[model samples]
Target: MNLQQLYYFKTIAQLEHYTKAAEQLNVSQSRLSHAIGDLEKELQVTLFVHQGRNVKLTRCGAFLLEYVSQSLDILDRGLEKLSDFVNPDTGSIGLSYLGSLANFVTFCISRFFEKTGKVQVHFQFNQTVTQTIEDSLMEGHTDLAFTTPFDNKNIESVKIGSHKTILIVSRDHPLAAQDSVDLTTLANETFVTYSPQCMIRNHIDEIFQTVGIQPKISFEALYDSIVLGVVSANLGVALVAEAVDLTGCHVKALQIENEIPEREIHMAWVKDRYMTPAVKCFRDFIMESGMLLDQYKKK
Candidate 1:
């Protein structure tokens, strides 16, 4: 009927002697008899037969013993698996990142696997457009996120590094011959820029305001690659991360003579969530060594 009762029956059936079973179980003979009696009455079956001074298991008792043994074994195994599941040292760790940090993040992932060999890592990429992705972090959809800094009171942030937003121009563009150009030099050039809410757009706006020049906007896009692709076609010059691969795009990254602050990259997570061992190891790994990525290196 219950675990204790089943255990009592199992011990008694194994010994086949009421007195010996009571002595081994450390219970009085009367107490053991009452418990067994209760079980037999509940099951409406005789589980033991008295044969002179000793006892023998009934047919039902032997069958029940086999099943109870298997049931207990399964429960024991389940407990152990549950214990392992809760262990912090190993398991899956979830992370979300901005697509721009791909190169830097991949480097860190290799380092993490080298240090913690057995942990399973999970990762997702988010464009970091609005509160949606940030809300995902807070709701436990991800344990960590690499993204542009934002004002979110529920999130905890760590400054990893910043990337210079360089000017990408077509190979045939007039300014491509120059090593660098001032922001004012592009004042009359139709610019390919990201959406208004994009952090890169904000930086460009700040530079324009500081130099007292309004950029002549020609095209706007949601993604940096599209903006770069357009610039490669000579439609216009665009500002983008210095690390963006311009290989087949036929674009060149040029430094800016006028001051334009680098776009910041940060690692953020929910403010007070419990970090598992795998997550903690990864978080510490990034915080301690993330700045060394070449994309983050200042040229």
Candidate 2:
């Protein structure tokens, strides 16, 4: 009926004597008998036969023994698995990140875990604001998120690094001849970009308005990869995060005659949430590894 009662019955059946089973189980003989009695009453079945100076299992007890043994095996395995998960030196750590940015951060995460050899990291692609993704982390849906310039007032975060937003043009473009291009020069040029809600898009729009440039949007895409594909076709120039791959494309940086804006990438967690030992180790590793700093230094 219950695990303890089942265990008592199993030991009693094995020894064929209540006194011996109780001594082996570290329980009083009366307590063991009472527990087995309660179990039989709950199950509405006789589990043992009493004869002159001898004991034997009932027919029902023989059948139940097989199942109880298997159940114990399963329970033992379950406990072992839970113990592994709770181990400080070996556990799983969950992480969420924006799609394109993973390419820049994956190496760092992989190397950190490899060196420690104590944590299993689970990574997810979650491209959302700090405010937006905080709920997921708080609700135990994710452990940490690698996000961009976010409203971090409500979340605990560390500025891991920043990515430069570059205006990329094809080699054949007229502006490619110049070492630098101005926002005003792009006013008449067709632009391929992400939706305005995207952090980079908002900054690009702000820069356009600040510089008095009114660029025409020829294509709007959700992903940087799509934007790059469109730009490779020479359909239009695009402003993208440096994490994007421009390989195989005749792409050239459109160095703005004025200053270009950059976006900060941050690793954020729920404020005051207790990080598991594995997660804490990873967090510390990321801070001391200098991988993000190295990435920011790249042109």
Candidate 3:
């Protein structure tokens, strides 16, 4: 009828003696008998019958025993799993980041594991654009995110580091010859840029507005690598974050002489959502090791 009644029935069914079961459960015999009597009345079935000086299960009791044992076992296992899920050193964290910050995330995670020895914390990583990352956080799909700063009342963010936005041109382009170029000098040049969905695109647009130049956008891509690939063909020059891997891309990352805002990286999470211990641990580590994480920036 209830958990306590089921437990008493299980113990009595196992030992087959009312006195022994009471001793094992540390309950008085009268209390155990009353609980069993109430359970039988509730179920309208006798669960035990007297056999000599001991007791044995009735036909219905044996059938009920099988189901009760299984249900209790499942409940016990569920409790254990919940305990492990809340453990700071052994739980899992769902982390999301921009594609460009993949290396930085790797560096931070490696250092985090090193500092917390014997940790069994699992990390699930998602690489996406800034808008999707923010959406993921808001929707509870991710526990933490590395992305560009945005205005969201329900999300909290802290600046981790920033990447210098630079101009990239093909090897044969005229601007590639210059060590540094002013923003005004490229006002007329056709530009390859990030899509409007990408947060960095907004920053790029702001810079264009501040410099009083309307960029003629010829191509738009979602990722920095794709934008670089487009620039490699000498199609158009692009302004992008400086920390991209340009190993096979034949584009020159030139310094911009004009003063512009750096593309800042931030660690963000839902303001009021419940965070597991592992997620909070990693979030605190990133907040404290901001400068250390900056050392692994792509050159």
Of the candidates numbered 1 and 2, which has the greater lDDT value? 1
Ranking 1 against 3 by TM-score, winner: 3
- TM-score sort, best first: 3, 2, 1
Report per-prediction Cα RMSD to one decimal: 6.2, 3.7, 3.2
For each candidate, the alpha-carbon lDDT, in order, equals: 0.77, 0.74, 0.88
On lDDT, the leading prediction is 3
lDDT of 1 by residue, 1-299 (tens): 77878878888888888899999999999989999999999999999999987888889988888998888779889878655544555445666665566666677777777877744555444545434557778789788887777687888888887777778899989888987888886668989987875656787777678777888898998776788789989999987777666768888778888766667778888888888766787788888775654434543
lDDT, candidate 1, residue 255? 87
Q: For model 3, what is the alpha-carbon lDDT of residue 181?
A: 84
- What's model 3's TM-score? 0.82
Model 2, 12-103: lDDT tens digits are: 88888877888999999889888988888989999999876556899999999988988987998998977755566765667767655766
Candidate with better TM-score, 2 vs 3? 3
Runs in model 3 deviating more than 4 A are 7-31, 50-56, 170-180, 232-235, 248-250, 290-293
Model 1 spans > 4 angstroms off: 1-90, 118-120, 124-132, 293-299
